[model samples]
Target: MLRGTAAVSVQRLAPEDLGPAAADCVFEALAARPKPVIGVATGSSPSPLYQALAASPRDFGSATWFALDEYVGLPQGHPESYAEVLRREIIEPLGLDPRTVHLPNPHTGDHQAACARYEQQIAEAGGIDLQILGIGRNGHLAFNEPGGALDSCTRLETLTEDTRSANQRFFDSPEDVPTHCLTQGLGTILAARHLLLIAQGAGKAEALRAALKGPVSRDCPASVLQLHSRVTVLADAEAASLL
Candidate 1:
């Protein structure tokens, strides 16, 4: 049955079983659309999904790709740079054209102007057709941290302590993590025609519960997903435990 204007489906599977399932969802979207604009999220939860896609038969030659966010102070070629990560994990592996890819430019001289241009570029491309997301331990979608405005757009946002701590693994230490980031906001994310979120492990259980079942609120940035019409949540049993 449909929930509101969109049908939300939750597929519960083992942690190892989630990659192929989510990859299948992505493949279906890509195969069904011409020049599909795909929004890619980076994280451990979606790493398996990317692996599955890399191993699949689907072709990514015709699709355009975009990354969800980037740290404010990272250098252009830093290992943790979103641009580099997308290139390594999604574009190169799939043989997709890097020229057709887009990511927020945190390294630019004028960050604010760069954000405006990024938003315009996405709009000019007809918005995103499908967006893959991973829930932060704090229920954040991309870098839309908790307590963020629900209708926010792609812009620079300060990172919360929890968010910084969670991402500290990618840096040398907590202090090495950027204090700010540029991310597509809840409104920007909801603009995508299809939204797919993947979650795994018990660490994501509480946020999964809030996003899937709790009332819509800005307190849980991901909970704003409940307002979108088309959303699919792929979760492992442990992540779905609280729900």
Candidate 2:
């Protein structure tokens, strides 16, 4: 049911199997090309994989990482900031040099310029070797909420109520959640040579199905994977039920 114009490798597995498998994939990529540049997503969904990756730090020495998105207007040290999350999960544990990891400045006054500069930095890093993703309840990617254009870029976005609610757990109260964010567009995400998306839990089943089988549309942003040359989707049984 997951139709694609390009050959996408679909690896369906139990959620319990994903963390180790993801580590193996990282190892393989690193073995093939040392100093590989990696694109990372933050959220509870990717925690397991990050834990596994952190367990093997030396294997990650050659890796450079880029975060998928950040909440606009939030300070860098904010507890809910993606930068803080990445530091705890991917940076410190993996012993990755801070200089090698690039993240957009969410608090920049000139957000548009920040985005353009970020894009240029990505290109200068030889492009992303692998991009990691997690699906929103509404099938969004990064912060690209439903209805995001297929060829989007790094820019500001108004967070949907659904997305804000889904992310509220990170804040003390729903009211504390930011209403805006800066996310990499579908086009930016698709530019990676390889894509790996991880989904788990029963709640993700519908979105996973939509991503793999539904029509590629701005309404279901993640569906844009249909156009990517290499995409590997790893999901738990509950998440893959529809597939």
Best by lDDT: 1
Task: Compose the digit string of candidate 1's lDDT tens values, residues 48-129.
Answer: 9999989987778888887888889877798988888888898888888899999988877888888888889899888898
Assess each prediction's global lDDT (C-alpha) against the native.
Answer: 0.86, 0.84
Model 1, runs deviating above 4 Å: 1-6
Cα error, candidate 2, residue 90 (Å): 0.9
CA-only RMSD, every prediction: 2.0, 1.8
Q: Identify the runs in model 2 with alpha carbons over 4 angstroms from their true place.
A: 1-6
- Please provide, for model 2 over 81-195, each residue's C-alpha lDDT reduced to its tens digit, 9 standing for 90 to 100: 8888888888888887888888887776988998888898899988888898899999999999987789999988999999999998889998889999888889999999888
